[model samples]
Target: MTETSPRPLRVLAAMSGGVDSAVAAARAAEAGHDVTGVHLALSANPQSFRTGARGCCTVEDSRDARRAADVIGIPFYVWDLAERFREDVVEDFVAEYEAGRTPNPCLRCNEKIKFAALLDKALALGFDAVCTGHYAKVVTLPDGSRELHRASDTAKDQSYVLGVLDERQLAHAMFPLGDTLTTKDEIRAEAERRGLAVAKKPDSHDICFIADGDTQGFLAARLGRAEGDIVDEAGNRLGGHDGAYGFTIGQRKGLRIGHPAPDGKPRYVLDISPVDNTVTVGPAEALDVTALTAIRPRWCGRAPEGPGTYTAQLRAHGGETEVTAALEGDELRVAFTEPVRGVAPGQAIVLYDGTRVVGSATIATTTRRDRTTAPTA
Candidate 1:
């Protein structure tokens, strides 16, 4: 007697017209899954289009995605997600900057627009799972809970930005490029062999919404000119800045201070006070931070109950450091094992355990430890 083959799962592949995502869709097809390709139309401003290595949602990218879908023999559709993208990603970016916070728009795009919105739509259309080109993994535990893990390629690991995904989102997600792939070169090479158009396309860089990789220019265009005084640690005026929104914590360059420090060293931006219209300058050592407090924390699989130690990374591509983390109501208090340099406010602090993502939160404030000498022996 002959046995019947199992039915193929229906998957919606989010193709960004890039080599990785193209290969991801092809791989899903090869796995005997019924796959469809979707390219999200995200950009609203026509002036946002620029021929550079950074822009991803341009007309060229959309055409490339459509061609890749044709090559893979899948039904392709371009969803007009411009309204949602602007509201969730671009608008949120502007609001964060205006409020003196540096926000990661890509992470917000992934969490809100891509996964949440697109995933829900796919499910409503009878798709079993939504797949992406992210270099991360989803695992099913013995207790029937899904867990998110880092990709095999540590250098290309994207778990840091994805740590904000909750358990429900992880369950409905699939990462087709997670387990087998290592370097981007290999993926592009495979795409070339498959005769895909985006095989040699350069990866998108910087913030997608910022057309020319000019955050200052973008902010000035949106928030207008708000000139402010540059001050010292003692609240003495040193010079002037274009805008407080243009500066961030621990920035050294672009500070128009004419004179050097008292010890003949370069002065760095230690603080940006929107209230006083001032940017504080100080020594590099002033950038070191020992503790960080975060608001709106989100755990991946489950939230930690009590004080527990975990490795925390403050920025994307930043080195991880051991930190004692505790849950205080809706906030997360993190005490670094050693002093971490340049812990900026408004950045996301992601906690990890080995290859698994634990949780993440936005840095509300960071406090430095005061060095005090004991009594003389």
Candidate 2:
């Protein structure tokens, strides 16, 4: 019997027209893979217009990605996934807001579009893997199974956003940036060495769909404005607002309440009741959240053998706090070791065991365990 050598892998690099993705595609090709660079046109007008040297997903970004592909000597193409993006990300964001929730659109995009839709299509075309520039390490356990870990560059680690990928998607994932311990500056330097035009391009921040950073205006434009009441925890009307969905938990600005608190203390948004069209405001102490119930829990690899404890992060960049989390039917009941603040529903709660990502879910409700503390204001 004749033994044949392993064939070169066919990798489809999803370039976002950034230096990180450009270098990722280059590295994949450099590693003897049959690499192809594909740019995902996420919106209709993807022109990179910079307010002050920061932009993303623009037309120039696409061209920059093509130029990088040209320099890397790989075939490149643009795939129009705008409609899918709107259905999967933008609409989901509006719906979440309509339901009085603060949603993370990036996490949804990674879960539904990149790893799910893009990966499914890539595999249909016989591609071995989908490559990207995300800064999160993917490790193969000694048992021959894969696991996701935080990047060596903690400051730029993107494991929080990548937490949505399940074991199936992780099997076909290739993050070239994850393998590096270097800073983003070093990645750009490598791009410069490789003659990639996006070497000096500014990294895009904020929501890509909202060209203007006015999330309130953006939501109002879609959901429309309606008169609502701003009430205190006791359900006493304090002020009137144009819309209730425009406000978020922990927001202290734009309350526009003419009457000051009886104690002359500032208050923060404690909750949003979309059903009643009321925005609940309370003192700062009321914002302490000690327990949160998250639903739709997804494990990166396997479900915890028997949930005891884990560290939970409420935001993409927020610090992880020790918590006791356990699966209860379809939901996750998490009890923080101390207390956290600003936890809003529909936002993801990424769970980690040390540096390795374990699971994540969308926050459904919050329980303020410190409510016993008297209102000092």
Candidate 3:
């Protein structure tokens, strides 16, 4: 083998039945790995999942994955993780929202299902690594320590969502598409050249379980509607709401207040109190958060020694902001260099050191620029 040749090993490629995963599996097989394909059945009733390009893990996706595996000359199987998905991702999403905090189901799915459960099964079955189409790179140092980094294609980089992966998961992960600097169009062309049927399949979006993409409706259906008060920061009742879980911090629209603020400025959701079932709306300036306290930090390699400056990404698709962070026992306290608007609890805060992912933690509390802290619940 050449110096650049990958060592032959047992590789489990998770085929999501899309252009990216299909191409990734093919590339892994082409690189001299002994590959097998597997598609995760996340929903018990596959028909209830999203169709076309709006979602994944549906019956349609399973069939597409099987075909791609056949084309790649690898064995394929579908693993039923429906119950696990419900308990971990779906239930956790509802629980977080019910507690007046916004949760990212995609991040939870990546952390719980793809990395934890699926990777654990693969490792137990004697697989050397779990391969995926995620647009992020895993670099191994000379000492064999692995580091997660952003993909070459910054536009399609997925390092933020994958930040929840710790050192153990990183060691047995393979991302075949991370080194490609070409555009998605080029990837489609490659798929076409390779005779893959999903060459033009559109990418999945939104939460996969919620087929209709109506998150508020989904939550309402599960948690039932409870009338609540929408109040201003001063405790003035501005309006009524069906449920406090329907609103998130920094939300300015769908408030249905009937009347504008006293200064004619738009009001944004600043706080959500599950205890009192109140959604606090205030001026946009009141939403600026200067510091936050996060819990359950997961590092890609070793934990940071003490207080250090790093760029923190509040959301999966959002940009990074400079922050000074320190670990105090079980919590991670981060002080942002500049105030950021719209941060909510239950969301994951991914820390990055330049292009490398450092770690991630769930936002438990946020301190506003005025030195007032929101309730941890």
Top TM-score prediction, candidate number: 3
RMSD (Å) of each candidate, 1 decimal: 3.7, 3.4, 3.1
Report the lDDT tens digits of candidate 2 across residue range 273-297: 8998999998888888878899998
Candidate 2 accuracy as TM-score: 0.94
Give candidate 3's error at residue 259 in angstroms.
Answer: 0.6
TM-score of 1: 0.94
Predict model 1's lDDT versus the native.
0.82
Worst 10-residue lDDT window for candidate 3 reads 368-377
Tens digits of per-residue lDDT for model 1, 257-370: 988878898788888777766788887777778898999998888898899988988887888899999999989999998887777777899998888899899999998756
Model 3: per-residue lDDT, tens digit, 319-354? Answer: 989999999999999999988988999999999899
Best by lDDT: 3
| lDDT against the true structure, each candidate | 0.82, 0.85, 0.90
Superposed by TM-score, candidate 1 places the C-alpha of residue 3 at a distance from the truth, in angstroms, of 24
